[model samples]
Each structure stands twice: as structure tokens, then as C-alpha cells.
Target: MKSDDVAKKLRRLQGQIAGIIKMYDEDRSCLEIIQQVAAARSALSSVGRDILTGEACKCASVKPGEDFDKILKSLLELT
Candidate 1:
């Protein structure tokens, strides 16, 4: 949840994306390419989950309500 941790995770995901690009350039097998795609997807999902959890915690700390749906809706509409 820290900036350093988030940066590290983003770097790892970037590396995975680069590897997928390299594999494509080298004409890697379909299975290998798919595997790399899956890995990248999993990494991105992990990062998203981390962000969501951290935000949820922060929101909960300031807002002492059990209306998660309302909170989430307001958060989503912010942008």
C-alpha cells in the first residue's frame, strides 16, 4: 500500500508486459504467449486489489458508516 511497494509492483508488471512483447517479437509459441498474457493479467489484478483495499481502509477510517454501496458509488462518481 506504500508508495515504494506500489512502485515495485508496477515495475514488475511492466517487466512482465515487456517480456510478452519480446516473446511476440521472437515469434514465441501460442501457449507461451498466452501464459505471459495470463501472468500480466494476474499481476495487474493484484495491483488493483491492493489499491482498492488501501482506499477502502482509508475511506472507512474517515467515514464511520456501514453503507459500503453508497461510499463506493460516491467514490466511483468522483471522476
Candidate 2:
């Protein structure tokens, strides 16, 4: 996905996080809070995967001799 798409996902996640906080403040049920927290975590994981996929694609397009070891290391660190 493109950066704009990632940004949009991040914004949505931000809203979800805020909502979770609101739920907590309002004394929502444990199950309800847990569900929202799980959803947010899934969304964040998706975003991270998207970013890594994009970076991998970019790296693949580079010339064979290019030094991608550092980039690969950084990407691995993210996981």
C-alpha cells in the first residue's frame, strides 16, 4: 500500500485507540474493551506488514549489487 493509505489506516487506528480509552473511562465491560484492544492490535499489525511489504518491494527493484543488508536488518528489527 502507498504512504497515503498507510496514513489513513494510522488515523483510523488513532481514533480506535481514543475510543478504547473512552470505553475504559466509561466503565465498559471487560469483553467489550478486550475486543476493541484486539482490533486495534490487528490493525497496527496490518499496517506494519504493509510497510514492510512496500519496503521489500522497493529493495527488490534495486540493482543486485546495492547494499540492502542494512535495510533488511532494519526491516527485521521491526518484526
Candidate 3:
């Protein structure tokens, strides 16, 4: 996906983060905050996966994969 598309998806994630902060300020339940934290982590992982997938596709199509090492590093970091 394009940077624009990623930014659009992240807008919702931004809201999620803000909500989590608000919940903390409100003295929300520990369990509830933990659940929100997990959800936010999952969302961030999903975004990283999407970006990696796009990069991998590009690397595959180009053949020889001059940037394969970079892409592989990103995948390892995400995992």
C-alpha cells in the first residue's frame, strides 16, 4: 500500500491509542486497559505486516532481490 493508505489506517490506530490514554486517566480497570493495550499492539503488528507484504511483493517482482536483506531484516524485526 501507498504511504497515504498506511497513514489512513493509522488514523484509526491513533484514536485507539488516544482512547487507551483516556482510559488510563479515568482510572479504568487494569484488565480493561490491558485488553486495549493488546488490541493496539495487534493493530500495530498488522500495519507492519502489511508494509512488509508490499515490500516483499516488490522485491519478488524485481528478481535478484538487491534489497532482499533489508526486507528480511524488517520481517525479522516484526516477528
Q: What is the C-alpha lDDT of each candidate?
A: 0.80, 0.86, 0.83
Judge candidate 1 at residue 41 and give its lDDT: 92
TM-scores of all candidate predictions against the true structure: 0.75, 0.76, 0.72
Candidate 2 C-alpha RMSD relative to the actual structure: 4.0
lDDT of 2 at 67: 64
TM-score of 2: 0.76
**Residue-level lDDT tens digits of model 3 in 1-79:** 8878888879989999999999999999999999999999998888877787777777675554658667666675864
TM-score: which is higher, 1 or 2?
A: 2
Error at 57, model 1, angstroms: 0.9
For this target, which candidate reaches the highest lDDT against the unseen true structure?
A: 2
Model 2 clash pairs are none
Greater-lDDT candidate between 1 and 2: 2
* Candidate 1 C-alpha lDDT tens digits along 1-79: 9868978999999999999999999999999999989989978877876777567767674554558657765654543
Off by over 4 Å in 3: 61-77
lDDT string for model 2 (1-79, tens) is: 7999999999999999999999999999999999999999989988997888677867686753446756665675776
